[model samples]
Target: MTIYGYRIPMMASLIVWCILWEIVGRLDLLLLFPPFSDVLVALGDVVNSRSFASAVSITLYSYAWGLGLAIVFGVALGFLMGTVPVADRLLNMWVNVFLSAPLSALVPVIMILFGMGAPTVIVTVFMFAVWIIALDTRAGVLHVPASLLEMARSFGASRWTTTWKIVLWAAMPEILAGIRLGVIRGVKGVVIGQLLVSIIGVGALFTTYSNNFLMEHFWALTLILFAFALTVGQLIALLEARIDYYAGARS
Candidate 1:
């Protein structure tokens, strides 16, 4: 009755790891690393703190908005580059330049320009993450098999029709992979932006705790961020798995 067979084992492994981590942390051989129970208590405290809730909400909001804008423009630009040589030529240099540059260093510049807060941080994250999505999508489109295109065209498929029907379907696996990578990088960029450009988020809290040598708080916040990233990554994997199953099995 199962549509796919992989989910149960993966979920079991995740649960096992969490249990093991809690047990190990509770043993507490390391003075600096607090028990998982303590971390949970801290999480509860942070969750109940209005200031922490507000900061977390702002961070999440900025992350969603920035990532959304990136996807919109990135996908559009990617499609344009795939279809138009001039678009690729005009964009290639700048794209590479931005990608190659140390964008984390320019957080101060972003702060100066945008004058602090979520606006600057979100922009910095988008700047760091968008190029990967655009470039990968463009490459995926270009590398699609010519035979597929010809077949679609032979059926008198219009330009738009071919793009949507054949090109997009073929490129989806790769495009989704790019999105997965971009999302992870975007999360990291958000943390970096929060630390450097603003004084908020788990990143900022982690910095403050570490600077004050509050190892328990530092590690607790870090664990939360790690869990967040892992959750996002797993969601992306689930999406990709679903896409592959639908596209591959529907002969």
Candidate 2:
């Protein structure tokens, strides 16, 4: 980023924040804000624990299932909505409502339906993620050029072939972008679900640490979750970049 006519690297900015955090922590400005060094040490301790491993495994399992289902159903529904006027009219209002709604309020309803189980968490993640993906994918489809469709038709391409090659490729960049955003939301959803419905996985650790006022451990776990989300989001962003290239090529 540029500041005072000088460009600063992102990592440099991060380091500055870390140093500031350390200073504030060491000064005891806030009891909740412990030293970064202590948090790092706690991170090492937490990572080596059996509880951490188990929690991670459960969280990952729920995340994978939720994200996978979200992508599959979201893309299919979005594709249909974009291509079919009737479907779009029928579903658009509901999609917009859900997107704008405070989904946290729905957690209790979800828990009621699915009970205190991994299924509830998976569904929560899916709920948080799917609407945005569907919306973005629909937008991608809507933006697909009419000329491309006509050209495919003129070339004797079947509807299926045109959709598969032309429509999908044209839409891929936005779809991937949506997926990246959805993944981040999905992470939040997983945590909320676990914390609210059942204290399992990383949620369990968060409960234990916060209840015991283990600030170092609490911050360490928070940092781990943040890192995991950032890493996954970065990977998805790279994929989006690659798909953007293809979209440009198609254009």
Best by the TM-score measure? 2
Compose the digit string of candidate 1's lDDT tens values, residues 110-223: 898998788987897798778888888898788777777888889999999999888887777667777777788888888888887787775667677778876766666777
Could you say which candidate leads in lDDT? 2
Scanning candidate 1 in windows of ten residues, the lowest lDDT window is 1-10
Model 2 poorest ten-residue lDDT run? 242-251
Q: How many steric clashes between backbone atoms does each model show?
A: 0, 0
Clashes of 2: 0
TM-score of each: 0.79, 0.95
Which residue pairs show backbone clashes in model 1? none
lDDT of 2 at 136: 92
